[model samples]
Target: MSTPNHKAYWKTNLRYLAILLSIWFIVSYLFGIVFVEELNTIRVGGFKLGFWFAQQGSIYVFVILIFVYIRLMNKLDKKHNLDK
Candidate 1:
């Protein structure tokens, strides 16, 4: 009954992309790379948070992050009536 707005759709997608990218960059580069040593003082399973972030933590975070993104996008899709 209504027309689709492709540009608006892409713009919305781009906004989400930018937000996700920024978060990824900050977590991977800034916290993991720059603050590794300072963060190593705190321990997680015999690993400092920074060390964890550097070695095993980031991978785990990435896995969790994928689920988070899926969950978020599912919610967003429902909110926008875009679910298929």
Candidate 2:
């Protein structure tokens, strides 16, 4: 790939990382800690929402985000003609 396309590819990758990491941080830290009390007012499967996020939800989200990142990188690779 040309230099410009190479730079754009990495830039997009970094942006994706930033956005996904931010989501993980919010779900794992904010919902699990900072907003625990408010979230605890609600429940899921008999477990407090905040506690669930702290213990399980965040892990689920992280796994989902891994798939999302893989899909995204696949598309990005195709866009940058790097899929070969």
Candidate 3:
């Protein structure tokens, strides 16, 4: 493999991070606060969707996003020949 390009690797990594963070912010903040009332109308089990998202959903999504980021970064690293 050729030498890994730090600038390009970090740039793509940051881009992925920004996108994931944006989604997390939207779900945890927007849906939890701004659209909570609307979302409250929908129920998941015994909990209001909004409340669930604010309390638990965001956490779950964050964990999932962490795994997704790991997988994505792994692929990216390999693509850039940085896995070594």
Candidate 4:
């Protein structure tokens, strides 16, 4: 790709990364800790929502995010004609 296109591609890539990471941070840190007590009032499968997030839910989200990132990057690569 040309210089401008390359720059745009990387910019989009970084933007996607930043947004996903921010979500992970919010789910893992904010929900798991800062709002734990409030979330504890809710239940999923007999587990406290907050406790689940702290112990397991965040991990699930992170793994899902990894797949999402991979998918997004693949699309981006195709868009930029960088995919093999």
Candidate 5:
């Protein structure tokens, strides 16, 4: 319905990427590793929260994040006519 703009699409993609990257770093690196003990009390699935995060949760989140990032980038590429 509307003409696509590459510059706008690229800018939006960069913004979203920065935000998601920040969250991923904080959650998996900071909360999961740096503050693990302080977070242990918040448990789920029989695993101490922080411990789980550091051991397995971070891995899972990273995996999901990888897929999400791929999808997001694909959409961005399509929006900007950069997809091949």
Candidate 6:
């Protein structure tokens, strides 16, 4: 790829990373820690929402985000004609 396209691809990749990491931060830190007490007022699967987020929800979200990132990268690669 040319220099400009390469730069664009990397910029888009970094943007994706930034967005995904931001989501993770919100889920793992905000919901799991900062807003725990408020979230604890709700329940899910016989557990407090806050406890779930801290213990399991964040992990689940992380795994899901992995798949999401993979899918996004696949599309990006295709767009850039970098896919095999």
The global C-alpha lDDT for each of the candidates, from Candidate 1 onward, is 0.75, 0.95, 0.92, 0.96, 0.83, 0.96
For candidate 4, lDDT tens digit of each residue in 1-84? Answer: 479989999899999999999999999999999999999999999999999999998999999999999999999999989999
Q: Model 1 TM-score?
A: 0.71
Give all TM-scores, in the order shown.
Answer: 0.71, 0.95, 0.90, 0.96, 0.75, 0.95
How do the residues 1-84 of candidate 5 rate in per-residue lDDT, one tens digit apiece?
Answer: 445475688678889789778878987999888999989988898788999888887788778878888999898888777888
Off by over 4 Å in 1: 1-4, 79-81
Candidate 1 residue pairs that clash: none
Q: What is the lDDT of residue 13 in candidate 1?
A: 72
**Model 5 misplaced stretches (Cα beyond 4 Å):** 1-6
Q: 1-84, model 6: which lDDT tens digit per residue? A: 479889999999999999999999999999999999999999988899999999999999999999999999999999999999
Which stretches of candidate 6 lie above 4 Å from their native place?
A: none
For residue 40, give model 5's deviation from the true position in Å. 0.7
Superior by TM-score: candidate 4 or candidate 5? 4
Which candidate model has the greater lDDT, 3 or 6? 6
Error of 1 at 34 (Å): 0.8
lDDT of 3 by residue, 26-45 (tens): 98999988899999999989
For model 2, how does the per-residue alpha-carbon lDDT over 1-82 read when each residue is reduced to its tens digit? 4698889999999999999999999999999899999999998889999899988999999999999999999999999899
